[model samples]
Target: WRRGTNSIAVLGAPQVILYKFGHPSDAWWGVLPYWAGLLILSAPVGLTVYYFLNDHTPPKSTPLAAFLLSLAFISSCVWTDLIASELVSGLEFLGVSLGVSRSIIGLTILAWGNSIGDFVADTALARAGNPRMGAAGGFGGPLF
Candidate 1:
């Protein structure tokens, strides 16, 4: 993992390290997998971007632009992490009350968010050229 990416993992390192060392509980195991999965996935993305982008392109805008983009991406990830972590932390109650588990919530929320975004964006693009389509976009959509 890249040096910067280490900070992202550091966010959840305590619980994960503790759980791996033999702390056992359903919640502990539950949280561990999510943190581990996030750590594993995030490390590679940062490493890949760092290795490939490090020397390839000239600086754009200014050092500030680079800093801002990095901050933006990290902040976005942190917001997502916050939601996932909060939901996981409260999984037991949520699972019982909602009649579903953390894994199901994660799957459905992420899947539907992406699907909805794609549906909206695609329909928007498709309507971009036609006035009739654009006019219809506000009231009806792709199926219409």
Candidate 2:
């Protein structure tokens, strides 16, 4: 029932805030050590969405880009938290239904979820013909 390590914060920078997921403090048979790496996809702020709507990058003569960017960012924050919460609840429910303890779910299912991002990013970048940016993304990541 507490906030723990998030995807954007941890996959990007862990030393700053080493968070760990856990069930209720008194629950001895529930989950613990869950590493749910939640990530907000780039479609909200990606160039494709912007280009699809605006037909081009943000213009320098106006504040439209800044305005839209901020709007998207704020919306992202709201949804990310919601999605993360739902994910944990869903996983925990699944664990309970399957007769598996929460701790094991955290250690196994949640941990492997981190690699999903890596797989998607590699495929996306390669298809986009700018795979090098993926490397840069690895170093920079979605930390903003």
Candidate 3:
């Protein structure tokens, strides 16, 4: 693997370093493609202009509605975190029982387990004729 001056060693595996293109001294926009940087910077500006020109009104939502939605979101986040921890623990136990290496277990089982939902959602979107969005999620989900 090619290592760059900007790369940092991966946790638990000191030999592995992830690299990003461009030097650390390079401007933030310099790291991205010219068109990508332009688009990223311009999108919000364009949207704001469009909304202002169109005189679009924001949706009216009650405090109760907002509170309930926030509560639900927080609850789901906690629930998922718990589920993921349990899953990791279970996978570790199974890997030990099967005499599998930690690296193999992490790379295969943990990776797939975490990403299965993204895979399914992307697959569904692709099947529904929104392949571009599906492709985006497929490629982008793991990065986040």
Candidate 4:
């Protein structure tokens, strides 16, 4: 049973990855990781640049220090993917056991739970410093 389940998970990964890479699904559930990674990787870079270029009162700390501080800002963005995968896996298990529909599990349980990290990371980054940089959409564009 375990082996079969593992095989299914391994095979399913490709479909998920391909779908995430722009398969044009209006309900693209797989793109969350890509979006999260963008936020995670960009926060440090953006904060470093902001510290250097901004004429306004920059962070009192050094560039490296500011960048490090923003590391959490970045990591928080992608942290959801790891967490969400686990959460969704568990939810799916329970849903399957209970004979719940996949569509409901995918849309409500997985989507809402995974999206929580995005919401928190976005809010945290914005509240931490520049609100503009915190936007996932804004940061993802340049990072990619």
TM-score top scorer: 3
Off by over 4 Å in 2: 1-64, 119-144
lDDT of 1 by residue, 31-71 (tens): 65544555565565455444544344533676634654665
The TM-scores of all predictions, comma-separated, are: 0.31, 0.39, 0.45, 0.33
**Full-model lDDT, candidate 3:** 0.57
Candidate 1 Cα outliers beyond 4 Å, as residue runs: 1-76, 87-93, 101-107, 130-144
Question: Taking the tens digit of each residue's C-alpha lDDT, what string does model 2 give over 37-134?
Answer: 22123323333333333433334444644644454465566557667878989999999999999999998998678557876796698679977887
How much lDDT does each candidate structure score? 0.54, 0.52, 0.57, 0.56
Model 4: worst 10 consecutive residues (lDDT sum): 1-10
Give a tens-digit lDDT track for model 4, residues 1-144: 133332333333434444445442333366555435544545555444444444443345786445444543544444556566677789889999999998998988776765776677778888999688778644573355
Steric clash pairs (candidate 4) = 40-74
Q: What is the lDDT of residue 144 in candidate 2?
A: 28
lDDT of 1 at 41: 51
Descending-TM-score candidate ranking: 3, 2, 4, 1
